[model samples]
Target: MSTYKKYFAAMALIWAGCAVVIILAYLLLFAPQSRRRLQTENQLKETKRAYRAGLKAGQKDAQDLAREQIQQMQHGLANFVTDAESSANLIFDLSQIANARQLDSFTIKAKDDREKSEMSDYKNIGENHIDVSFTGDFNQFATFLNAMERHQPVIFVDQFKITRPKRQGTANNVNMSLAVFVRKNNES
Candidate 1:
């Protein structure tokens, strides 16, 4: 070959070697850095998506909790009104029971039966039971018992007794004692 051709070939070889060295340096150093940058970008996107989903779930839970509280308040108010109406109805029913039973003379005695101590026989809670006494016929007493049971208000007849009048000489009248449970006046 000629001398000029040999010089041209050497120049080409030097240029090619420089290009290979540069490419190898980039592969060893910058390539790993670029891969790490891509991984970081993907992680950031996943985190943003997760945050949005968590926020939506939190909002749904708050709404469900608020609705539950409102329902509980409404139920409590309804119960209060029902209790007040029941108390008023109980009073009227008791008066009606007295009239319908055809009692000759009835007395309602309220006494608290809670025992404070065995020695003193004093009540602690001080709630009262009802004692209804009258002088009436057997049929009238039975009718009173039936009416008491049929009444709208709740009434528990705890004890009752029918006995002939114990006096000088009174045979037409009989003594009747009825013990019943009445709701306390202070009850809600």
Candidate 2:
């Protein structure tokens, strides 16, 4: 080979080796760094998003929540009642729920006034527990309990119990106590 041709061949071989080294360097180093940087960016974004959501939740958790609850309590307290007519009407309402649920042998009776006179703390909120017993399927009983919980007078379940059915395909016997917290109205 001529000297000039050998020189050209050597230069071409050096260029090819440099290109291989550059490719190896990129595969070994730069690509991994880019992947790590992308991962770090995603993590940073997620952390910032969580921080912003926490800030929004923190704003909601302020004293305004307490004030809102107090307002609700005041609104509920406005419906306090303690008269024979009110008690009778409330009983009728409960019987209506039992009837709607198709419960058998439903019975409800309000506890006497001695339980009411004891009052509940400084709020004067007293709970009058009513004895209730009925025979029904589980579905009907569940719906009855749901209706009682969402009743307009704010009824709460106190004592709840259930007995197994005496025979297969028979209704279960259930006995429950419900409570109503009410302040005495001036008219009473």
Candidate 3:
């Protein structure tokens, strides 16, 4: 009976040592793996948050740039409208201009730059020349030219011709023809 009791006690001590070893092995292996998994999860969450913040900031910058461009275009359009209105009101008083010139038959010819040999050079040119023919004395023709020169907006006269009446019945009248050029002020 004494020998059996000693064997039973030895077996119990071995079982208890095996149980302790198993517990230590599980803790050493699995604890490190679980801790590493938790750290990885936290890192993934931080990365997602940073990406979201950056995306939001990028969207805001795009919106601001679009708004700034729209405002600039609007300002440019307003300035263009003001300038167009000013230019449209710049036509001279034709009746008064004609009376000052002693003009009988006044005809205006407007040729666009599209007809120019160098089309690009005259694209912005808005100029017209008035071809005037009148039966008047030399003094009246000279006074008309003088008046045109003294006008606020300058008129350029290029071609001039005066002829005595070819027929006997129209001896008192002189046939005169002249070209007067006027420019539209688009800068206003």
Candidate 4:
């Protein structure tokens, strides 16, 4: 071969080898790094999407809970009364209940103003306090208490005392302090 042709052939071979080395370096080093960067970006996008979905679900859950609580409060408000006349009517209902149970004697008295003041701190809420005394057999007393519990106005028994006369064949006496809750108009 001619020397000029040989030199040209050697130069072409060297150029081809450099090209292969560059391609291999790119595949081995730069390609993997670019793949990793693409994967990291995809993961970040997925994380952001999941975070947004979770936030929306949490907001919906909180709204549902708030709605449920508001409904309960509305129901409670419906059952509450606001006036003295209604309180007296509830007491009259109690007397009728005692009559139905055939209690020997039933009496009720209102509590003092000092006692009512302590419970009036809650907004638009008031409590009616009464001392009740009755005389009846055990079965009749149980029926009377159950009737009171089932009555329209809610009654709470605060304290109770029962006594049996020393003499046989006498009815037992019961004394109880009761509190009934009522809702009042917001006065200021």
Candidate 5:
């Protein structure tokens, strides 16, 4: 009821109104701006992720490339394959080695008659698999494998298992799994 108290109450009410107006202004203006900033940040993050993924997909890994080069160098001929026909001679060469060793039951079969699948990591390098089975004495089989390893471009013998058949006296059944890596480009 006193004039001073009335004046003080009016001041407090005005200050409170000003505070409410400021809060409303922030809610109307800064709030949307903050939301837009957050959206932009999220978009930027997504773009960066996509760009990183593209970079990863575009370039080959150095260590992996080095390992491939080393393998090719060891093969003695980097221009080992250009296409399916280029690698077809592997089967024939293996046949020759078997014939030279006089390996009986010498049978070679391609895992897939078609060309190398897209599973290969390198666009220019190709990989092929074959299952070679033969019957011969241990010595003959060893000689055959050495000859294959010594073949000009080098053939990788993944594995070989020898089992003696009951009927064959001293002959051993040799089952071999081979992995051949050849370059699709003659560039070596």
Candidate 6:
């Protein structure tokens, strides 16, 4: 071949080799990198969707748990009150407790119910007061108080007056007022 043709052929060969290298670099490096980046982006989007769904489900579970707890509390509160029959039963129970404690005397009388204010959360709630009188030793009185606390229908000691007898052998006299919450039978 002539010198100019040989130089032209060498240049053409070099150009073709450079083009091949460029194509190989794109296929080996850039193409795989772009594919991996696309895969990572899709995984990230899927993870975010799953996280949001889990968050929504968790919120719903929390709300349900709170509602269930409130219902349980309401039911527990319902057990703290006594109806008319239960009130009579409670008086009898108190008498029994006093007898068990060996008190000198014991009496229980129910008073009128106290109405709650309209603005109160317990609007239909009423207080049933019970006047209790007992004569006993200090130990017996303490036992009586403890028994009252552990009794059903949840009695609350409103007020009390204690008087010691003039004679040492005589028992101490105690007058106490107790109260318990009850649902009103008739709503106004």
* Candidate 3 TM-score, C-alpha based: 0.36
lDDT by residue for model 5 (16-122), tens = 99999999999999999999999999999999999987777567795577678888775645544335566788889899888888889899998877465564667
Candidate-wise lDDT, in order: 0.62, 0.81, 0.57, 0.82, 0.81, 0.82
lDDT of 4 at 89: 82
Leading candidate by TM-score: 4
Candidate 1 has a TM-score of 0.38
The per-prediction CA RMSD against the true structure, in angstroms, equals 20.2, 11.6, 24.0, 13.8, 9.8, 14.4
lDDT of 1 by residue, 1-188 (tens): 69899999999999999999999999999999999999999999999999987786579786788789999986754432234335435545666787876677766654456445232433222122456677776778778778876654335565677777777444324333323322223533
55-144: candidate 6 lDDT, tens digit per residue: 875797867887899999987886787665466677778888888888876888987554653324665666677899988877887898
Candidate structures ordered by lDDT, highest first? 6, 4, 5, 2, 1, 3
Pairs that collide in candidate 5 are none
Worst 10 residues of 1 by lDDT: 119-128
Q: In model 2, where do residues sit more than 4 Å from their true spots?
A: 1-73, 79-85, 113-123, 185-188
Better candidate number, 2 or 4, judged by lDDT: 4
Estimate the lDDT of model 2: 0.81
TM value for model 5 = 0.51
Going through the candidates in order, what is the number of backbone clashes in each? 0, 0, 0, 0, 0, 0
Worst 10 residues of 2 by lDDT: 114-123
- Model 2, span 103-155: residue lDDT tens: 99999988875453445553545567788999988898899999987777777
lDDT of 4: 0.82
Alpha-carbon TM-score of each model against the true structure = 0.38, 0.53, 0.36, 0.59, 0.51, 0.58
lDDT of 5: 0.81
Q: Which scores higher on TM-score, 1 or 5?
A: 5
Model 3 per-residue lDDT at 46: 100
